[model samples]
Target: MKVRLGFVANSLSLWDASPAKTITYKRYTELPKEERMDRLQEVTRLNLEHTKRILYLCAAHEIELYRLSSSLVPLATHPEVEWDFHTPFKKEWRELGDLIKKFGIRASFHPNQFTLFTSPRQHVTDNAVKDMVYHYRMLEYMGIEDHSVINIHIGGSYGDKEETLGRFHENLKVLPTHVKEIMTLENDDKTYTVEETLAVCQKENIPMVLDIHHHEANLSERPLEDYLEAIFATWEKRDLVPKIHISSPKSEKAFRSHADLVDAGFVEGFFKTLKTFDQDVDFMIEAKHKDLAMLKLIEDLSTIRGVKRISGGALEW
Candidate 1:
């Protein structure tokens, strides 16, 4: 069995290298008409450049999995500010895709919490579709549309879980089939449990991204071990390995919040459970410390009896 680990956007080791830099709509409205588009383009260019730097850093460290910042382009999905983010930056996007392909890295995007399908309003669903398209366009421009994934939660249960899930199914239809093929649903900490999210994934023929910490915080009636096989099975249609989100709690009082570094002790049982499956998986570290957290967790996990550090970010058992 093999497991590769990676961090989320914005490595703390890199100074001023956040790919999520953006101009607020308020700031954009205040700018002169001539400078508005230029400002958006300028921020986007910096973001693309920073993204390239992060990709190089990942390659240097042998990190094989990364989640791209969805905010790569300012006002990308805004109802009024949507502009051509692809035309002027073809070279930059291609460079990012090339780096990812050259390093054999598995890149992905996770849209924000608002980019969900279970909303009750038509405008909300429309915005959700727009947001998904925005994400899809980035991957399309990068020329990695087929190789990458975009993950989201099952969304809020509203007041009625059954009715909301039905709405979810109905609203999901708005997404284009091609984009939906690369979409994944994750178990959220507050509402959706592993069982529910896995069921949705199975129903939709999408992959499930098990968030171990969320599973811990939000208990399900069934044991996690019971869902292991089904969870792994969801990724069978996809070419990439199954992906999991790993994080630790901030405190007992704030159980749902992510800590700076993942505590090996907190995840030991989950790792043991996964070891029984005899499959390869990718761990996307969701800690506050970013890359440093990933490195620490790698070192921590490699100390287990059956695991060996195969590279800076990969382990074999």
Candidate 2:
């Protein structure tokens, strides 16, 4: 199909200027349970507003792949803690299903950072799979045909790559067929890169969600194009690579500052190289400013592709 560009909603709440706003990771974690719910209600309402803005951007230039975070649906029962963020079966999920159709966006529910596939905790991985699987089933049961994806990290590289891949393979076999089909893997900041991720995906017959920034940040020794080519080559049988996590990398900032937007240089160079690739890909901008990052990325794509700014065109340049 067509290539798409969108944003991650995880950092969208950082823009709220409410005096008592506690939608942040710090405030949400430490705030009393009662206070967390109150603030979450406020942020949840704001999420709808943000969705409207996001839809406008995607509609303006016909961007594809709206990468949505699970946090967008507020858990009124337990909104603060990260554990409760995985509420795929919640009532809000049904509402979100309708909203995805309403907005006409192909949405994917991105799992939380705490949902590590190789966590030391016994239940961390199982519970993570539960949340991810639940999201796919709920939307499917709702008859939402927009095509959703659950993006995941290949867990910590830890010591041995082959050993970790073995465990990951076992875990994939346990996943339900529907959930397994919807699952895609992304390169993490520490353990994995697009190439390594593709290796695991190739073995398991799953697709990949390439994060350009993650590979660069992890002391990657290869050229950017090499990584991209390897991933596409490995998944040559697939018609489309579902999603990519893009953002401006702030070397000095932590994930908390994930919103720190990257400039146009990387975006410009990257999309240009993409034109040579034969595979179709969808993208998500994971910046401190998701909406703005998407807008800038679209603009850069248009400039690089040398296309007139037309409404509802898949490629920008």
Candidate 3:
């Protein structure tokens, strides 16, 4: 497989017009479901149009477009007047499938953030698992799962590391496995860096996603080399080595502002770091401006590698 650098779409597309300038999960959760659905409907229309526009922009600039999958769920939900367990989505699942098919680009969803397979809450894990199953099924309905798998946040850390690992392994054993080999686990900012994730991957035999921004925020305070060592340690023992999830050092500078790890300089450094490793890996750039950030980063990295390729250009999709 060729190396790829994509971007997470949610952060880039759904910006508020407010002065605060940061997206909040709470704000999204607080909106009425109806209202949320309505807004998402509008965003989908615009975003789909924008995707076409961006293809041209990227192609013109010699950039390659990679679409993250999670950003499409709201659009996947059937937007009907009412939603109930019987009709998880208001609209037909086929409708959602059609839209994704029409988009005709590479996209994948991240695993459920609110999903906890190990939650003590009797129904929490079950419902989350159902949603996850639906997502994969929907991807199949859309004909995307055969080629794409959604990214997932490895549930919560749950305080006890050993217990958490044990539960993850136990829980996964019972889950349905319908999607292709694209499903991947990412190291998050809150818990589990790449090295720790690597250990679990060794046990579970799953793919890895190294979120560089996450490592900087949580693990890089110690010597970066040690953290990198942690990443290398499990590659051989694990069935799949994670080299995806791209970013630069993240800052706790505020409850808000962060250094733009998606910048070209960081991509250069990341590519440099990768050059020393003797394996193939795929990376996704999760900068503040998903696609925009990735365009610049990949361009810079490719230039550094002395190769050249242009995207489909602004007019070609």
Model number with the top lDDT = 1
Candidate achieving higher lDDT, 1 or 3: 1
**Runs in model 2 with CA error above 4 Å?**
1-3, 10-64, 72-99, 219-222, 227-230, 233-242, 252-259, 312-317
lDDT value, residue 104 of candidate 2:
68
- CA deviation > 4 Å runs, candidate 3: 10-65, 68-105, 179-182, 220-243, 249-261, 278-280, 302-317
* lDDT tens readout by residue for model 3, 1-317: 23555555433433431111222345545778667655545544444444444434433444333543443334243333212222333343345444445544445566557755555565666665666775676566555576565666667767887787777766766567654245566677777766677667656655566776676666734544445555554444334434467766455464123345555665556556665654455566666666656656665666655434334211100
Tens digits of per-residue lDDT, candidate 1, 1-317, equal 89999999888888999999999999999999999999999999999999999999999999999999998999987888889999999999999999999998899999999989998999988988888888999999988989899999878989999999999999999899999999999999889999999989999999999999999989889999999899999999987799999999999999999999999999988888888898899999999999999999999999999899999889998
Task: Give the per-residue lDDT of model 2 (tens digit) for 139-200.
Answer: 56445633666777877746887777777776666567767776777887787766677777
Quickly count the clashes in candidate 2: 10
Cα distance off (Å), candidate 2, residue 131: 2.0
Local distance difference test scores for all models: 0.93, 0.62, 0.53
Query: Could you tell me the TM-score of candidate 2?
Result: 0.73
Angstrom error of the Cα, residue 49, model 2: value is: 8.1
TM-score of 1: 0.99
